[model samples]
Target: MPSMGCASAIAKIPVSKAGRKNHNRHFGHSEEILTKEEHISAMTIEHEQNTNIDDGEFDQIPQILFEGVSSLKTIGCPGTLIPVTNQTRAVICGADSNNVIAAASLLGRGRCLVFAHSGYPYMFINVDVEDRRFVENCRLWLAKGRNAQFVLIDDTQSLSDVPLDETILVWNGECIKNDTFMQNLHDYLRQGGALVCGATPWGWLQLNSGKILSDLPFFHFCDFIGIKLTENYSNCSNPMPFQLELIQFKNIHHATQKLVADPTDIESLCIVGGACKDLNVDVSGLPIDILKNIAMKAENEVIPSNSCPIQDKCCRQKSNGLCGILCVLTSTKAPGIANFPGDFSHPPVTETHVIFHIESNANEWYCTGYYAVAGIPIQIDVLECMGAMGWSIRIGCHSDHLEVCF
Candidate 1:
């Protein structure tokens, strides 16, 4: 809910007690805490590297990189429906590199900075040397922007040991106990920082053993987790079938709800390119494409402008297969009319006392029938009528002095 500002400005804001309380409620005390020295060391290493190309030509870099840089802004994790600024960053740790990479790609296209762990691929796909290199390339691209930074964290360390003061923490994979690290992570997130995370299927099994899954501070720290603690089930699956999915928070309908209470604070974000199908197959033996389509539809349908009546009306008319009429009266005969493309068809024009009927159904009115206007008014019924036949219609009128075709 805070305005997009410099990272320094964000860091200056004091952590609220409520945030601390929330953190305590989720993650219990850990044995190994991250010393202040370690945190500093990590940040130092991250800062030392110049991820950007030394050549001043910004155009030399891949467009994806530029897009990623542009998208950098304060993003509410898991619930990153709206970007808060142009330099926000996401911190992903302990997850498979593949899922992180996929998510990073989506976020980057949206202009958000992504900081992910350099561990194993998060998905089931075999991540070879080339794949690993691509992941690193993404990091470099993200680093090029003044708004982005890619921090490669050591997997051996627990998430709790890492500093999460002003970052949106995405904790994925299995649990690594470090009470101090958890406390800091929780504190950072509870103070209005965003987080998105998911446990591995194996971790879910462990949780099923009466381990009090929801009791973990990180579980409650995030706005939404892939899995449900109380129910021990996940509404989503890994290797998501779609490039991006809109995560719905409790009682929030609009995507901008996470950014601000105002209706105008949100903007449309894009899902450029990434693997959309699930890496793991389901029991029905159906292709992952089905799930991918479902997710894509869910995400795309939530565009901020979708609430506008005019937009909805246009979409509705298209769905009903009705093209609006555009009438033009010309003095040219036949006029060597061009055929409508395959995407559209031309309607037939008959001269038998044609009656254009506008039928109203629900809240919309559409042309439903056309009557023949023949001499002496002979009624003719046509089974099918095509609307908007062509750019122009031909009319023939005969007079006593001259035969005119218009």
Candidate 2:
């Protein structure tokens, strides 16, 4: 409803406002509220030697929000959506050895920044002087230039009233069951409206029936944005499934360069990766020898087993399938690889259409998709997923959209 900047725009995004009570109530002023000296001492010991925000561009503007912040002390936590640090659009702003403290990116026509922790207004109570300066700086930065108006849609009930302007729309990952709301979003994006749609497919699946990508209420929107949610969840211990690389998509999509950021921060941010049956075709019963041969014989190919380790699971599951080269294997007849060693009638499976794999992580979780349209399409990246907790997408365009993302 008001003009927004990068950092300020995030505050207006429709995230849960729970856990806003003062931390003093949870820790009791006597025990948890450290005196200035005590607080400084505790945080000093925790700084580089113990804190996770030690490395990388922590000095970046986003780190100001964490200044003087030793640890989170809150109650009735509403949880948070873990932003995917490795996607094409996301830029890791700050992180430590364990997690990403902050990330920023451009989507469609707006900017977005995400942090792993929560507790807003209350957390701002008794802020450090320097930290306060950081807030003021962000405000000043916005006033200086990025004073674009933004809209945060808390519910689909108000979709009909979404303002007609250049304002960027931020959708709170609420599932849209109504077609009118879906149509509104579709038209909005088509008309160059910016959007930040949050998603929590895995969390939705916990309370609902069926698979995440298909069952989640915001799925139609997910498809429109070329994002897919997987059942796999990542944490401090697990690693992200896909490598962080800005890709230059073929055809009408433009190429762009990699935004300089810490790969560790990027990897630490993605919390979900899992095999989704809907995103891949069944290549289970296909002969392993031919599949391996196809993977090898294809130009610029590597062994499928080595490249796609998930095939092992598919091998064991029998009913499930392997993707990538196998997807090509089922649909094409490679010169040397298509034929079995001897059986003349058994030309390895072939189809009328070739299934081209656009996403590099297709072997990992099959969570990204591509669709071609008549006009220039909105090229977006699936920044992160928090399973049932929800996910988010940023839409904006800059001059350097040609950055490659393989």
The TM-score leader among the candidates is: 2
List the candidate 2 regions with Cα displacement exceeding 4 Å. Answer: 1-145, 164-166, 210-212, 236-278, 281-294, 297-406
The TM-score measured for candidate 1 stands at 0.28
lDDT of 2 by residue, 349-368 (tens): 43222232222211122222
Among all candidates shown, the one with the greatest lDDT: 2
Worst 10 residues of 2 by lDDT: 250-259
lDDT of 1 by residue, 33-147 (tens): 4433343243234223323222233223333433333222211122111111111222221121112322221121111222221123231123344344443444444433232
Off by over 4 Å in 1: 1-21, 25-130, 141-173, 183-198, 201-208, 220-254, 257-406
